[model samples]
Structures are given as structure tokens and as C-alpha cells.
Target chain A: MQLVDKDQVSKSLGGRLIRNNIMKFLFLLCTLVGLVVLVTLIVDTVLDGWNYLTWDFLTSFSSSRPENAGVYGAIIGSIWLMAVTAPVSIILSVGTAMYLEEYAPENRLTDFIKINISNLAGVPSVVFGLLGLTIFVRQLALGNSVLAAGLTLSLMILPVIVVSSQEAIRSVPSTVREASVGMGATKWQTVSRIILPAAIPGIITGIILALSRAIGETAPLVVLGVPVSLLVTPNSALDTFQALPMQIYNWVKMPQEEFQYLTAAGIIILLIILFLMNSVAIYIRNKFSKRY
Target chain B: MTDSQLKEDKNMGTEMGTEIGTEVKQADNASGIIESGQPVFQAKDFNLWYADNHALQNINLTFSENEISAIIGPSGCGKSTFIKALNRMVELVPIVRTEGHILYRGDNIFDKKMTVEELRTKVGMVFQNPNPFPKSIYDNVAYGARVHGIKKKKILDQIVEKSLRGAAIWDEVKDRLNQNAYGLSGGQQQRVCIARALAIEPDVILMDEPTSALDPISTTKIEDLIQQLSKDYSIVVVTHNMQQAARVSDKTAFFYQGYVVEHDDTSAIFENPKDKRTEDYVSGRFG
Candidate 1:
């Protein structure tokens, strides 16, 4: 055999080495950035408010004086908003998902609807707030109350809920449908009994995640003119409301150091609530997935 | 063996012809023993199409009340299509169309008076793969009964137990009725599907390669169960396994390229086939 050339071997080896080095560097850079962001958020939040996060701060009602103020009203408002939004959003979203995933035929109109839904998911939260201000708040005559805010947020998160629920319903095997239909069950019966039950875990997880996002939203509520402070909780749809994000917003704008501290404490509570919701969603997904 | 036996055999042949054209079979015992009366279904000049492709061509056959009739053919031979047509199941496919007369208990099943749902209740079908719903075993069997409006707990429990026993899986799954059916073995799941079908108490049961997805032992168990089940319900099975067809069926219909090459008693079809193609296929000459 002829002797191999040194230059050719070196060139091939060098090319491979350079390519691998570039890939490794890119991967490491991405990992570093991700880790840095995660650590920074956690460390900054802890350092900013850990000492002030107490039961008294959590349970006490809000006050005009920075030293005495708490997040009770905002917490209650957030709870009420979620309670109202969850059921309404789930009903509308799951129903739409079922119709689209199961019954809707392939057509241009459906395709248009699907594309618009994805676009709506990407639409800015503030834009939704603007729309709510003009439509639900003014035209529809619903004032800056929990009902108006809840409805606005429901529309904002509706796309996410529908998309996620559709994925869940679509994931159920077609064999299950055939089995039910072959057994002489009606279309409605099969959907309700077999398809709905199998898809419940997925739907619940999606609803929780979507609701968590809705709970954190502030711009739409502000645009809808939700109150900055309220001693008594709103009892009806027409009464004005103030939520967690609005409370945080209001406190952060104040010039006093005490109000700043209170805002940070509220931020901690908000993060904990989000973390809890995400964990519950993850648990449900794991539980249902194990059965399949 | 004897002169009297020879004469009886001749008489039986003539009697067989008159009975064959009329009554299909009725279940009697563990064997697929046909009682020469009571035809359950009759198909005359049946044809089917999936869009433009011709699937089944001029099929004429009869299924007895309590006998297992096996439809054996090569791939794409339309055995499954024919079975689906019997229950109007082919309608599920958007492009599927059929031109045929399938008479069930002397009623034209394709008539406006006969709804697909009503026809399905009288004739149940089991697919090739075992597909138990993502529910408890008891619920899997009880699903059909509940759809038909049986709600009392005691009544549902009785129906579930009876169906499981009929499908020959009661002894294995009875202790774990509350457990999810998806956790079971493939063979057990197939039996659960069979039990689900049986829960409706249909007059006829159609199985599409019910044992193809099973292990040898499981296949044997299902074969034995099929033989036992023929005592109460008529079974029309489509299988690729020749031995399964010969073992479980009293009558065998050999289909080739969407045509019925031969239809006769299982022994005759296997041992002394009237058609050369059937002889070649059964003797392993060609598919």
C-alpha cells in the first residue's frame, strides 16, 4: 500500500476537531446561560424578601400606611378570580377542543380557526386588556369588577386551554373509539364515557397551567381599572375588585421603603403559588401517564 | 366400516344439501356441533368498494346460529371487509360503499328500517388486536350494558360476571374486577374485548383474527374458548392461520383476491378440496 499523506490526515482530523469544539462550546454556553438565569432569579428573590415573608404578612388585610399593609385583599381577589375563571374556561375550552378534535371535518374554515387560536395565544396580554376595557368594561357595561377581570383573563388564556386540551384529547388512541362504537354505544355516549374519562388528567393539567398563567396577569386587570386597594371583598359581579398583581403594582410604585419591602414579600407569595400550581400539574400528568 | 353406515352417509349428504341452503347451524356442546336448522344471517351477491378500489366481489354465504364459520384468505383478500359489511361497520370509513343484501333473521339489514346501531346490537364484532378501554375490568364489560340503560348495581354485576364467564376469562379476572384492564397481558385483554362484545348478548359474534396477536398457549386457550362459545352464539372468524380455521370452524370459506374460491365443510376444504387453488393454498404450494 502507498504511504498516506500527512497533510490530508491532518486536515481531516483538524476539521473534525474544530467542528466538535464549536458544538461543545455552543452547548456549554446555552447550559451556562440557562443555569445563570435560574440561579439569579431564585437568589435575587430570596435575598430581596426572605426575612419579611411571614404569616402575619400573608394573612393581614391591606393598609394605606406602608408599615401595616399586607396582601390579603389581593390574595382573596386572585383566589376568587381563579375560582371563577377555572370553571368557565374549562367548560368553553374543553367543549371547543372536543368539537374540533373529534367532530370537525378537514376544511378551510376549521384551519382558519385553528391558526387564529394559535395567533391569539401569542397576542400580547396588554392588548387583551385594551380589548377588555373597550368591550366588557365599557360597551357591555360590566365595570372594573372581579367578573370583568375574570372574563377578560378567561379570553386571554382561552386559546392556551383549548390548544392544550385538544392535544390531550387527540392523544387518546383511536382503538379506544372503535371499541366503544363497535360495542353499539352512541357517538355522544362514547365521547362522554370513554374519550372524556381517558383525557381528564391531561385536561386538568392543562387547565391548571393555563389558570396559573391567568393568575399572574396584571396588565389586563389594570386596564380594566381594578381597584388599587379594597378593605372589603367584592360580593357581586358589579363590585370593584383588586388582585395580587395589582396590589404588587400599587405597592412597588410607592416611595417608602416599607412599601417596597411589602411588594417583595408579595412577590414571594406569588412565586410560591405559581410553584405549587406547576407541581400539582406535573403530579397529575405523571399519575395519568403511568396508567397508560 | 359397515353397509348400513354407507347408506346412512349417503342420506346424510342429501340432507346436508337441503339444510346447507337454508339453516346455518346452532350451538350444541363444546365442539362446534351444528344442529341442522335456524340460519342467522344470509348474504347474497354482496359487493363492496373503498372509494374506487373494488374490495369484495359477489360474495354469497350464510352464517349459522351457533357455529363458528372461518373465513381464511391471503392478505387483501377482503375477509375483514366482508365481516365488517355484515354489521354495517364499513360505513365508518368515509369513502366505503357497498352494494349487497345482508339479511339478518330474514330482514334486509341495509333497509331504511334497520339502523346501524340496531344491527350492531344483534351482531357484535371483535377486532384483531385486544383493545380494552382505559377503565377497570368490570367497567369494560359493563360498558355495553350501561349504554343500553342497565343501571342497577346488582344487575350490572350479574351481567359482567356472565359475560366474563362466557368469554372464558372470568376465573382469571374475577378477583381483580376493579383493576384497570390495560395492565393485563395481550391475550387477557383480547378476552376482555370478547367479554365486552358478549355483554350485549348479540345473536352473532364476528372476530377478525382474534388469536393472531396471541401467544401459542393463549391461542390454544382462545381456540378452546371459541369452540365452547359456539354452543351459545354464532361466530364468524377471519383468520390467516389454516390450522386455527380447521380446528375451530365447522364450515370454512376460502377467499382469494376478493373472491370466494371454496366454501365447504372444514374437513373437505382441508383434505379433499374441490378447487385446485384451495388445494394448492391449503397444501402450502402457494398463498
Candidate 2:
């Protein structure tokens, strides 16, 4: 070979080095920006409400006057909403996921259903609220009660549950299915005994995350006509409810400075509850993951 | 030749079945005095297709009770498909189509009156890789029993212990019964799978390369377990490892390109093969 050009090789190597450096710089910049934004949001929330967070603020109920406002009713309402919504959403989501992943044939109709589910997942929360109002409250004649709100929330979170449960069910190795079938287990037996147990942790984690979203939602609840203030805890599904976010929205909109402080207190409490739920979900995931 | 080489040649001979006819002739002479009963399972003119691609072509075989029958073949020879068809496991695939009858104790398993679930309970299976359920070790072994309606705790406990013992894994895993099954080693998991199958109290146990995923030691252990298991239950094992077949099985069937080229007593098939294709396959000339 006519003496390989050393100069060209060196030049190309230098160019490659420069390009690599620029690519690394861009990656670092993006990561730093993301971390800064996340930290800023957390810090702002903490600084705004640090002083207002107290035990009495947490334990007391709501009041008509902004000065005496507490989150007891709102907290209870959130708890009740979660208790009702989570089970319904989970059952519907997991069932849908199982039917789609395991039983449903690969056809145009099923494919269409799957595509619509993903699209529904992207639909705005307010749209879900509107759907709930029309379907559950008006058409179903359930009224603007906790039951209606819960049903609405259940529908709102259904897509999340389905997607997560599908992923969980899908993650179970094909070898497991083959082994079960090889062992002479019926399809249903294999699903219930093997696939479901392996996927339970993932389903639970999805439910927790979806419930967190449901807890913080305000636009949908507003559309459901959940009351801004409620003195008594809801005793039945038909009773009007006030969620933490709605209560905070009511408190923050008040002209009084004390109410703004109370709003911060409410925000802190909601964050703590969400944090606890997330932690429990993480714990369950870790525990089951080890077993799997 | 070394012991290993001798063992290899013996395996190669079994796979080829060049001497199977002679071996069967000798066996006939020796066993002419003894009376044999009906086979546990009889498949007559069994044919299977996967959407027009014939997977199994005119397979006819019968498996005896309390005997180990080994199916040896190169990859994609329809050995697995044939075994799956016995218990209606292949029906799960929408594309799979079958013709002919698989009779189990005088009743056609494919009859409309017979359910796939009922057939499966009678014919349990173990797989190539160990697949324990994501449950406690005790629960993993107890699952089959529980499914068949053994609800009492003490009864389930006894079944679990007995099945584990049957699979030769009870002593190793007895203390850690409550531990998650995933924590067990690969060999233990495979044994646990065997125990799970045993807990169902099936009449026949189907094994598809049950030791292919394990180390040599584990393979030996599983082979021993299989030999022991055949004393009580009919076993039909599919193995790519020729030595494994000679080591454990009483009868050997050599399959080539989806056809059973030769089948006879293990000693005869190994000592003198009857088919050139099987001989070539056993000699590592071609799959």
C-alpha cells in the first residue's frame, strides 16, 4: 500500500475526539439541568410551608373560617377515595390486562382496543372528570357524591392500571408458561397459580402510583362538584366529599394570609401521605422481587 | 478406550439403533416366558400439523406402566410436539392441528367428553429448565395438591413432604420450607418441579430435557431421580444427551427428521443400531 497517510489518520482521530467531547458536554448539561429543576421544585415547596407544618394542623378538621381550617375531613376523604378507587381500578385493570395479554386473540378488534387504551391513558384528567360526570352522576343517577367521584377516579386511573398490569404480566418469563403447560396444567390454572402471583407486586406498585395521581387530582374533582368545605366525615358513598387537593385549593384562594399558611400545611400533609404510600409500594416491590 | 469414551460409544450405539433388531430378538427369546400387560398409553397413527407444516408424521407408539422410555433425537425432530400432544398441551396453540387418537386406558383422550384439564392431571410434566412458582418452597410443592382440592393444612403438609421425598429433595429443603423458591439453586428448583408433579399423583410423568440446564452433578442427580421415579410411575423422557438416555432409560426411541427410525430395548439400541440415519446422528456426523 502506498504509504498510508499518517497525517489524515491523525486529523480524523483528532476530529473524533473533539466530537466525543462535545457529545459528553451536552449530556452533562442536560443531566445537570434536570437535577436543578427537580431540586428547585422540592425546595420551593418545603420553604413555603416549613413553619406551618405541625401536629395540630394534621389532626384537626376543616372550618368555615380560614383561621380554624384543618385537613381532617379532606384527609379522610382522600383515604376513602383511595380505599374505594384502588380496588376497583386494580381489579378492572388487572382483569383487562389478563384478558388482553393471555386470552384475547391477536386480531384487528383487539388491536384497536389496545390502541384506544393507550390513547385514553394520554387523555387529560379533566376529560375523565367530564366523562364521570355524564356517565356516573347523571346517566347512572348516582349524583355528585363520593361514589360518583370514586367511580370517576376509578375510570381515570384505569389506563394506568392496565398498562402497568400488562407490563407485569408480560415480564413473567415464557419459560414459566411452558413449564406450567408442560406439567399438564390447564391455561387458567397456570395463569391463576403462576402468572398472577409473579405479577402481583408490579400490579400493586402500579396501583399505588395511580392512587397517588388520583389523590392529587383537583380538576376532575372540581368537575365532579365535590364540595369546597365539609364539616362532617362522609358516612356513606352518597355523601358529598372534599379531597386534600380541593381543600388546599379552597384555602389558597382565600384572601387571608393565615389561610395561605394553612394551605401550605395541607400541602405538606398531602405530600407526607403520598410519600408513605410510595414507600410502602417500593417495599412491597422489593420484597416480591427478591422472591421472584 | 477410557471409561468416558466407552460410555460415549455406548450412547452413540443406542442412538444409531444399528443392533436394535438383534437386541430385540434376544430380548424376545429371554422374555418369551413372561406375560406382558397392556400399555398405559397408546397412540395410533398420530399426525400433527402446525398450519400445514407437518410437525409429527404418522407417529405410533405405546408406553408401558412403571417403565422409563427415552426419546432421543436432534433438534426440531418433533419429540417435544409428540409428548405435548399426549396431554393436549399443544391445543393451547391456535395453529396446531392434530389427526388420530391418543388412547389412555382404553378411552380416547381427544374425545369431546374428556377435558384437557383431566388429561393433564393424569399426565404431569417436568421441563428442561427449573421453573418454580414465585411462592414459598412449601407452597411450590403443595400447589398441585391444593389445586386438586386438598384443603386441610396437615394433609397438604404430608403431601408436600411425601412428594419432596419422592423427588429426592426433601432432606435438602426441609428446614427452609417457608423460604421463597427462587432462592433455591437451579438443581433444587428442578427437583422442586419434580416434586410438584409428583404431588398431583399422576400415573405418568413427562420430562422434556429435564437436566439440560443443569451442571453435570445436578444432571446425575436428576437422572438418578428419574430412574427411581419409574418404579412407581411411567416416565417418557426427551433428551438430547445420549449418555443420559443409556444411563436412565429402559426403552429408547431414535427419531430422525420427525420420524421414529428405530425403537427397541435400550441395551439393544445402544449395542447394535438398525438404521444408518440413526447411526450417523449418534456418531455426531449430522443432526
Candidate 3:
């Protein structure tokens, strides 16, 4: 044979091209599948709940009559829960991440700790609920109140926040760290000034996701014996509460057809609140991200 | 200096020692020259190990105050390691272990009482690649002083101006002080890094192949700046490019396989190196 087989090579190239085209089409389908389902669900809910969703539905509390029912108590109770959860979890998770990434020695122990932290993220939320029940509800005598429930949710998301924050901290370039340290700045100064600023976008993204998860979690609150529906809005962290997901879950369990419409309306409202919260977080992330 | 080297190499090392031994001739600090008699860094039989690998072996070199000293070496030859050791920047690597001493102003750099940050304050460093913090040009220059506790805006502005001027990039960046430093070209960014180092006013500035990443024109600008900065600060620069070392350094140290083959006046080292390896290296015989 000559140096190359021209006919066979062209045939193989054509076959490879067809295979790549087929794979490209398949990948597009994979990418759009999730978006397709999400849009379908939202459209169906909006169509079913459009008429029922109103200021009245948001202003009142649960009632025997579907038309008179609302999610005011649930909404306010969720707010109280998050208010307690956000600051406590953020401070704890970011501090842990900082210590692990910057100060911890590179050894078997730190690796073990890191692996366990990521594992904790995969642990069931109900287990955290039981932990909260033991520590906050029974032992600490906080009862089935907002503080106990919020802490339980915080615990559920702690591993997620810590792991993500650690990743953000790690993503900071070693070159920047060297430059800072080379300038005679202490380790703490380098971290606070250079690394934190560069990593802020990633850290903020982690916090936003964790907080959103905290807002929607029902299992931990359920394990803590949180009510399915609250007639009165919680005024403080020590008071009883119900989150949006728990409220929606309660409405779905109701037998009345009128309550079905109410459930869809409540979902829309929850989605709106989540949307608003994410918008603010995204804005902050964009502001800080531009510098790096 | 350690066991197993060529016998002729040891004799030349002691002969070179006499020149360094009598180099304590300059004492004044406010001006240039890296004057003799004041050894900013003296490595006496200094050896460094990264875990099991002997990275630098029995290094005996003296960098005088106010002089521009160049270390020329091939890859893995330990020039970078030696300069990093001068400021204890090598301590960042946890696996590193050292024997003997690299002294700065008569104090061993590894002395427990003297912290790394304190040593770094007196000895700033510029890396091979330009690395500017993700901040405004003004903020980048002012950062060293700011971290050291200079907060007043007026003083910071002055220091920033002085530093940029020192690095000779003030005219290019003066109008864009608020712009992000990453917006600058490679040469400008390197100058900003130099300015950032100058803000601290260190006694000795260690540069690891400062112009290896730049174009020829930019490299020339940096070489000129190095010569200019030598008037006030002692600088030890490591470069693989023989021409760069020849053009900028007053004294040249030739490193090969983790050992200094020769350390002598730049003219002598280039013209009549005693070691065959050095002569071969400078003559393009083999790196």
C-alpha cells in the first residue's frame, strides 16, 4: 500500500463526523430536559392559581373555608426562621472554611476532616432534625419554636456552606497569596485583604444557595415537630413557626379541591420570595466579582 | 564545600572566599552601591533540602548592601531556592529543611525569635511573572504600606505616588490610578509589582527572574529600573538569560546542579571563569 489509504480514511472521517453530529444533538436534548420540565410545572401552576392568587390570600391565615385561607403566618414564620439561621450559619461556616483552607496542616487528619464535611452534606435532613430536637428542643428547652427549627435547618445546610466556602477560598490563586506574603504582610492580613476579596463571589454564591435551601427544607422542621399550618405569625425566634415548604406540603395533603388552588397560589408566592432573595444576592455577587 | 565535589572546586571556593571576606567596606545605608563590608545576606555552607531532595548544597555567597547581584542557572539549579531562602520565603513550603545559615545583617534568617513576616518586611520580593492584586492601580501600590499600618489617605496618596514614580511607571498609570491593575499590559503590571515592593522600603529586594516573562523592550526597561533601584536598595536577581545577568549584575553567581560553580566580579566571571562548567555555560557550550 501507499503511505495512506485515501478512500478508507475519507470513509472513516465521514463516519466520525456523523457520530459527532449525533452526539451534539443528544447533548442539547440533555441540557434542555430539566428546563423543559421546570417550565411546564411553573406554567401549569400559574394557570391553575392565577385567579386564586391575590392580596387576600397572602394577608389572612388558614381557615376552614378555602376562600378565606392565606399564608401570612407561614410567610412571617419562615422569615423569623431565616433571620436566626442566616447570620449564625454564615459566621460558623465561613470561619470553619477559613481555618481549614488557610491554617490547617496538610496531613491525613485535615483530609479526613474535609472528607467528613463533604459527607455531612449528603446526610439526610431528618437526622439533623432529630439532633435539633435533642439539643435545642428537649435539652436546651427551646420547645418546638422558631429558634429550634431554624437551628435544625442551619445544621442541615452547614456542610454544604462549609464545603462550598472552602472551595471558594481554595480557588484564590497562590500567586496572589505569595505576592501578599512577600510584602511582609502577616498571614491574617493576606487572608483578610487579598484572598477574601477574590473569593467573595464564590462565598456569596454558596451562602445564597444554602439560605435558599434553608428556606425550602421541610424534613428537619417536620422532625422537630413543626406544625403543618400556623394560624398566627411568629413574632420572634422563640415562638412557634411554619416554613413555606411545610405550609405547601400541608395544603397538598388537604382533601378539599379549593385547597389545591390555594396550594398552587402559595407556590407562586414562595417562588416570588425566593426570586427576590436571589436577585439581591446576585446583585451583591456581581458588585464584588467585578474587582477580581 | 560539602564532601564529594571536585577537589579543584573546593580550592577555588576558598580563593573566592577571600574576596567576599574583605568585602565589608561600605556601611552607609541611605544611598546605593550594595557597599562592601555590609553583607545583606551571607550564606555560609548553607544547605537546603526539600524533604529528601538536596535542592541547594553548601551554598557560600555574600550579597552586599546596595549592589545588584545576579544568579544565573539552568532549570532545577537552585537559584530561585537560594534567593527565596534569603528572606525565609522558602518557609512557606512545609517540607523544606535547612542546615547551616543564611544571615541577614549578621542575624541568621532561621532564628526563632525573628518571625517570617518581620524578615519579609525588611526583604521584599518580586516574582518572575507579574502578579498584581485584583485592585485599583493606586490601591496596589499603597497595599504594602496600608498593611503595615499607614491609613491616612494623604500619606497613602503620597506613598503611592512615590512608589509608582520609583518604578518609573507613574507617567503611564498616573491618569488611571483608579482603574483595575489587571487592565495594564505585562510590563506595566510588573512595574506595579515593583512599586508595590518599593512601598515597603525593604533593605534587600529579591527578584526571581523578573523579566523572563516580558518582551525584549520591556526586559530592557526592567533592567534599567533594576540598575536605578540599586542606588538605594540591595537587589539579588535570578535569571537564566546570561545576557541579562551580564547587563545588570555587578557580581554574578553561576549555579549548576544545585551547587555554585563560581561567584566573582561580573567581568571576570564572563571573561575568565575559573570553573570549566561556568565557562562552558556562559559560552553556550551546554546549559
Candidate 2 docking DockQ? 0.40
Candidate 3 Cα deviation (angstroms), residue A266? 1.1
Q: DockQ of each candidate's interface versus the true one?
A: 0.44, 0.40, 0.53
Clashing pairs in 3: B23-B37, B24-B37, B25-B36, B25-B37, B26-B36, B32-B231, B33-B66, B34-B65, B34-B66, B34-B67
Off by over 4 Å in 3: A290-292, B1-37
**Model 3: per-residue Cα lDDT over A1-292, one tens digit each:** 6989999998899889999999999999998999899999999999988898889988988776888988888888888998989988999999999999999988899999999999999999889989999999999999999989878888888899999999999888888899999988998999999999899888988998889888988888888889875677776788898777888888888999989998999899888888887887788788888543
lDDT (Cα, tens digit) per residue for candidate 2, span B135-197: 888988888877777799999999999999999999999999999889999999999999999
Best by lDDT: 3
Clashes of each: 1, 8, 10
lDDT of 1 by residue, B115-233 (tens): 88788888998999998998999999999999999999999999999999998899999999999998899999999999999999998999999999999778878888887887788
Better candidate by DockQ, 1 or 2: 1
lDDT by residue for model 2 (A1-292), tens: 7688988988899889999999999999999999999788777777777777767666677886755667888998988888788788888989999999999987889999988898888899999999999998899998878889998999998998898898999999877787676555667988998898889899889989998899999989999888887778889987777799999999888887788778777887888888999999999998777344
Off-target runs (Cα >4 Å) in candidate 1 are A1-29, A59-65, A106-108, A255-258, A287-290, B1-36, B272-277
Each candidate's fnat, listed in order, reads 0.67, 0.53, 0.76
lDDT of each: 0.86, 0.84, 0.88
Better of 2 and 3 by DockQ: 3
For model 2, fnat equals 0.53
Q: Which CAPRI quality tier does the interface of model 1 achieve?
A: acceptable
Question: Candidate order by DockQ, highest to lowest?
Answer: 3, 1, 2
Worst 10 residues of 1 chain A by lDDT: A283-292
The per-residue C-alpha lDDT of model 3 at residue A72 equals 84
